[model samples]
Target: MANQVVSLSGETTQPSRADVVIIGGGIMGVSIAYHLASAGVRGVVVIERAALGSGSSAKPLGGVRATFSDPANVALGKRSLDAYKRFGEEFGADIGLRQVGYLFLCRSEAEVLDCEASVAVQNSFGSNSRMISGAEAARINPFLDPEVLLAASFSPQDGYAEPSRAVAAYAAAAQAAGVRFLTGTEVLAVETAAGSIRSVTTNRGTIRTDSVICAAGAWSRHVGQMVGVELPVTPVRRQIGMTRQQPQPYPEVPFTLDLSTTMYFHNYGNGMLLGISNQQAPGFGRDFSFEWLGEFNAAARICAPSLAEPDLEFGWAGLYENTPDHNALIGASDEVSGFFYATGFSGHGFLQGPAVGELVRDLYLGRQGFMDVSTFSVTRFHNDDETLVREVHII
Candidate 1:
């Protein structure tokens, strides 16, 4: 039976089969397909519940930085930076990637020392990251209020990109390389037999395949429930607000984050893009409300006062598929064989998508390409080994 192509209007075609079935169409899933296709692995199918990049991939602030307290995250960020640098040349699509650098504001002396140490580790891994004092940081970002900041770390190579464009680039490259995409289709269940996934039951139909990669983002926990695996990935609500078009002198400002309050903002053309992690309980659904906008406005005012009196353009709320640690889970599961998991990315999914693609390729081909992601395996959680990252700013 041929695989079915289901439309958003409840129209369904025939069923389909592939060698590998990807359960999500976000950046992680699409990039995985792109990498698989690049590696000469044909017959790959990507299934998305909604339009591509409509999940957490579309909602993040798109901060691409290598200034991490963890080594694994640093490696992932470095690999992703390499991919972003050569993306336009190889994929023939402008991902809107900019290298305006990232300014991480530090408030306390402890955070300043930690930032310096992190810069050392990042420099060891060939990253052009360095620690700067509050005075020096003010020179880089004049709009920042240096009185509250004790020190800061600036990474020139770390920047931001348009999430939608990045996802489009991956999708276009994957399609050009013969990867099949099934949008507007939901995965109903994971059909397994003898501890191995045989196929996936979807709204359109069943997709028979040998391997299944679950990159379902916020819905990843639900996807894992199909196989009776309780993934620690939970959906935490996050809100973002954008201002109306206003001419500003600093148009290319780097993505700025206040470590003290976890407030972040960046330049987005004429206006600014701002967001803060919601303090509300998890599971807020997808509704946009004034309450979230109020919180965002308050945070933005404290971080960047210029954005306080903007037109109040509007706000949006999305889920952050958080893991036990702030890091991502990117390895095979022990409960289910022939089933791989790449969901819990916290909030770094968009920037890390390309490297994750390469990682997925390495995992499929049985090769340890660049970084060993075994530390993020699901088995570690079961064995009472939780590797938690202590980064405070998670927006």
Candidate 2:
């Protein structure tokens, strides 16, 4: 055991040297570690300030979907979805994956048109998503009132999984592959020389490495600043609630989301899991509040008028590593040699972790990645608005 961090095993003696040091022990970090080690890259180490998977990656019910307005995001999400389907076989970890599907409810003509275009984009990428009528949407989730919906989009391959379980699974497999975990080790500085990563100085110890990957989740901005890289990631709080089980089991339904209200729900235990983006939610908060419940109730009454809000006895808050356009930032840094990052996924990090890990690994090894991620580079923010990647179908 080494540096134990919150419900995690103690770490071994801190390493003084490594081939690569990844900041943050969340999904992206663990996934990159596992993928790199599995690819025969040795001497990889991951540093986390707190317990692994204790960040946004700890969100219990994480939705996984290939449904997106942008084709690149669709590719990333779809590839990761396929990887997650085989996680049990490859990583020997059951992530409680359920492909109950995702249904996006549109309430306005503009929303319906946008959803239709999004579905078209998804279908162009072989996602198998399609536009469905309000009646068909009702059949999938009886809780919704069809009369209020203009139209909807459905993706059968989209669903939810246990985020913490997936993170643990990847961390376990990575450790088994000889990847070191420096839990509770806060990164103080990313030392560089002649515009290249030399080592990382941490609270516990310094690890000399030629390469560094910043996957520090919501705190990625600070990590980037330490290396003179502008990561442009802002932390925004998002919350979720679980209802007390009911007397009778509710019928299983797809993870249903109302685009207009940014409210969503899915089956959880014998009741339901509810979540809604707080428009007035300030950035960077640690505690969950009942303040958002009023907004949640207002949206609930409109989206699912028949369903009563169950005794909301369970809930938690987590941050979203948001970027200006709500698209992920994943690429190697030209300013700092041997520096790579995959952050600012907004709310899509967990679903895209597997694909992003492989991309970063290829970039590290100087191999051509499966997809052209030049569009995701941090350098894009420096150029015109047209160069930046924007995702319209985000929560």
Which candidate should be chosen as best, given TM-score against the real structure?
2
Q: Native-vs-model 2 lDDT?
A: 0.87
- For candidate 1, the 10 contiguous residues with the lowest summed lDDT are 1-10
Model 1 residue 112 CA deviation (Å) reads 0.9
- Clash pairs (backbone) in predicted model 2: 1-11, 1-12, 2-10, 2-11, 2-12, 3-11
TM per candidate comes to 0.92, 0.96
Cα RMSD of all models vs. native, in order, equals 4.3, 2.7
**Stretches of model 2 off by over 4 angstroms after superposition:** 1-10
Give lDDT tens digits, candidate 1, residues 1-395. 01112122233342567899898888898899999998999888888878878887765347787778777888898889888889789877776778999998998888888888889889989999888888887788776777777889999998987677777778877877877788878888888898888998888888888888999988888888888787788788877777676755445678888876677778766777776676767773877766665665676566567665557576667778887766788887677887888988888887788898899888988888788888777666676543443353365
Global CA lDDT computed for model 1: 0.78
Q: Which prediction has the highest lDDT against the true structure?
A: 2
